[model samples]
Target: MEVAIAAAAVVAMGTGNRVLYKLALVPLREYPFFLAQFATFGYVVVYFSILYLRYQAGIVTDEMLSLPQKPFLVVGLLEAFAAAAGMAAGAVLSGASIPILSQTYLVWQLLLSAIFLKRRYRINEIAGCFLVTVGVIITVASGSGTSASFKSTGILWPLLMIISFFLQAADTVLKEIIFLDASKKLKCGSVDLFVVNSYGSAYQALFMCLLLPFLSKLWGVPFRVLPTYIKDGAACFLNMGSISGCEGAPLLPLLFVLVNMGFNISLLHLLKISSAVISSLASTFSVPLSIYAFTLPLPYIGVASSLPPGFVAGAAVLTAGLLLYSLPQARHFGNTFSQQK
Candidate 1:
């Protein structure tokens, strides 16, 4: 039962994340890039502030303020960069047959948890990791229906995608560490989770703004002042006219932003209810879900090309590996929770 609930939470979070990204974050069409960044940060701040206020009102504990400063900021920057780079790469290599590399983070998380956090896993857990790795390799190697055949000359783009995504996993591990530390120190219940996350978002927003000038110069674009960007963003937020030269904006993207916010909230709630390891593992399910989602005909990318029977067979084998890995952990988690109860 515990396993079922955990798995359900994972699946729900995964689905929510997909919806959020597709619906919310993708919308805001006419805003400056920096404005979008601020919006993202503002959303986080609002969410966290609500939690903190609740805590102060005796609805949650106050220890939420104990979040570590340095490590959290450092990890946040890494995560931000990874995210930005990966998004760019995904846009560039939409249907390329580069191995779906995000799961590499699972291995990194497991290792970091074991080494620095002193978290121990049974042999079965290790076995689960191995199976997941194999599954990833199989899934990638089999190639998706939409997958572009590998080209030696054009490999650099996909390779960069893999590297950025690997860094994303590393960021995930670091985030988990920060969250775990804050949780342990604050003991103010789940309220602290929201607070820490919100502050982290704020930090990332500031960091991005500061770095934007340099990035603009590098890309050979004129740098806009932060305040100017914010003013333009606020106008967009207020439903006023967009800045000059900006394309007309739509409401759908704003709706998507709300959806993304919900997704983040749901994810944090899951984290409050469960271990980071479980949350991380559950997130892996997203890759498969995303593949399935992208298979449909859409505005940006059309339906995936049909695959041969061999590819289908390979996919099944890969899925079997994933199931083999997760089953043991699920069973063990159930038994452990039962004993504790």
Candidate 2:
């Protein structure tokens, strides 16, 4: 029952993270790098703070994660690149096209899991992945106007986003390996999810700091002048900016960071309690839901998004695919891969 509740929370939080971030992006229209860095550094500070308190209270110990820290560092670095690239791609791709194309990670995850994690999936699971692609496609393409175009350079950004998400999927698969290995060799047998959250985030924050020069350069700010940009962003983020109009700009990202971190914790919890396949599925469920969320006359949703004609049909098909994939008989398929070990 607890696991079920946690999984449900994961789905809700995951969806909320996205919708809320969209709202945040409204105010953050010109501060993409700031938005990214704030989340990175914010997670580091927030996660490690919780870790410290938990450690003192005897709720967690570093020893539980007997694995070397390097893997998590590598994961963080890859994650940073994936995020930066995805954000860059988003600048070109249509809002509707980005999420749809990003679902390509499902396919990449399956392939990576098969090759590296030695994991196998049932026929239905594979079909479910395909259905996800189809569902997202219908929703995106059947809309009033397609976000991605097939002609000229219109398709390039979506493709880049897909590749970035492929890297993101690869990162998730690698984290799964880390968990599995720790479960096999560590004294507790399974590392705590928060531990990974803390360390992975910390490493990512570190890497982001290291990459600041490059990020600043990309933003056309020189290395020495970058400090002023950071200061200005941090100030506005805290609602201390002189620009009265953008005073609220920082607040949205701050809220976004909090929600996004919660979503991360929920996802890690789901991943820890279940398998990567289930974790992925849980996240996949969030796409349509998040889209539906945007359609409501919610605060900050300046203009409610209209549901495309194919939305219901696509959602129904997606739900069916998820149901088929989650059928209990899928258990047998898992054993085939486990037997290879």
Candidate 3:
């Protein structure tokens, strides 16, 4: 039941993210510079405020805020940059051959955790990682398009997209470490889940605001880019709602936002209740599944066109790998059950 719930939550999050991106982030392209930031920060403030209130009520703790300042800030900035770049890249690459750039941060997290966090992976974990890689490779390599397209163009925009994907992966690992470490130290209940995420988002929003001028100057782009992106995002989210027959729905975005919040909270909770490996694996499954679900209807757009026989074959291979990876872990638990019996 818990697994079911977790999978459902992740699916909801994956679906919501794509929809919200389409509705919210794509429309704010025409707004003023600071106004875009204001909208973003405003949303963050509201989201985090709910978490803050929970903490103030003794439902969580201040220790959630006791993260190492430098690393946290750096990671936050990386996350913001990755997010902006990824969205922008997706927009630019929308009509291209490869639409979905499956940023498997879970795989990166597993590797980083093993190296830095001294995480010891069982055979099952190792197998799972292999499966994930195989699946991704199959999905990417076998799907379609020329090998040249897969090759890096050395162009600024595509390079940024690739960088964004990598940075987002790093950010996921950083987040998992920070939140998990904080929860262990604080020994708080699940409420800290809300508090920690809320703080992270708030911090990221502030950091993004601070970096705006530098980013604009560095890229020789107008500060207007920020508003334009925001408007674009907003319009995308609104359109998603409309397409889903949620037109003029007052709380749809809010609901979607909360669902996203729920996803993070659930992920944090899962990390506590289970191993990071398990959490990562579960999260990884959502990525391809989301692509499959969302792209099935619009088979002509983006990565959908590539969903030919080879893509399906690759997806199958990936699924087989996931199963292979789970076998050892399952056996270990099964042995424990047998001993008890």
Candidate 4:
């Protein structure tokens, strides 16, 4: 019952994360890099604050904090790059298509698990992967010519978004490796999620600071003007300054950050309590819901946007793929991966 409840929370928060992100971007449309930096640096502060509180409660111990930082460093680096690519692409990609493209993360996760964990997948799992690919093709093709969302940006950004998912998958797998290695180092054979979140976020923020120049360049904001740009973004986010187009302002961005933070913590908590497969399934369940959310009459968006052409067909196929892939994992719960035969 606890796992079920947690999984449900994961789904709800994940859905909010996806939708709120797009909405938040609307107000910060001119400052995607600012949003990205805000999230990265904010995670560092929020995570460490929680870490401290957990330590005071004796939930997190010295040993967990003392574990080798190397793994967390790599996790940070991967996440930094992933954030860069994802934010760049997400700035242009439609909200609905973002979730659709994110489906590829599952495919990448499967491939990474096979290579790193020496796992063997069943025939059905392979079929599920194929279907996921087909569904993505349908979604992209359906909107390519007609929808301004895709037509304006072309296919490059969407493909880059998919590649960002690949990097995110790799970061996730590396975190798993950290957890596995911690078993050998810690007497409890497990580490608190906050410990990982805190350290990884710290490292990510560090790298983000170092990469600021390049990141600014990538976002077409000159490094010299980044401070002013961030200042304007902050003012706009707060709705305090004379910045134009700050329609949604603090409320929208605040909700997005809070929801995003909750979603990450809940998903990680779910992973700790339940199996990774279950955790992933919970998050995956949010994709369709997020797609549908855009079709609603949400604030800042003015009119309720219509569903992207072929969305129903593509979503149905994608859901089928997810279920088919999950079937084998349901039968073999608790094992990180099935042994290669």
Q: What is each predicted model's overall lDDT from 0 to 1?
A: 0.57, 0.76, 0.57, 0.80
Off by over 4 Å in 1: 1-7, 19-39, 87-99, 133-163, 182-184, 187-191, 214-251, 295-322, 327-341
lDDT of 4: 0.80
Per-residue C-alpha lDDT of model 1 across residues 195-244, encoded as one tens digit per residue: 65676676676676666665444333457564565566566544567444
Top of the candidates by lDDT: 4
Which parts of model 2 have CA positions greater than 4 angstroms off?
Answer: 1-3, 147-156, 217-224, 247-251, 330-341
Model 2 per-residue lDDT tens digits across residues 87-107: 667766666666677678888
Candidate 1 clashes between residue pairs 3 or more apart in a chain or in different chains: 23-256, 24-256, 24-257, 27-253
Best by TM-score: 2
Candidate 3 — worst ten consecutive residues by lDDT sum?
25-34
In model 3, the runs with Cα more than 4 Å from the true position are 1-4, 23-43, 62-71, 84-104, 140-146, 155-162, 187-191, 213-221, 224-259, 275-277, 295-307, 328-341
TM-score: model 3 vs. ground truth: 0.70
lDDT string for model 4 (1-341, tens) is 78879988998999899899989999898987788789889988999999999999999999998888888899888888888888789767876577667778877877887888576778877787667666655654565453566677898999999889998888877777677777777897889999989988888898888888978888889999988999998988888878999888889999999999999999878867654545666787776677679789888887785666877887788678766765634344486546331
Native-structure RMSD, model 3 = 5.9
Of the two candidates 2 and 4, the one with more favorable TM-score, higher being better, is 2
Q: Return the TM-score for each candidate structure.
A: 0.70, 0.89, 0.70, 0.84
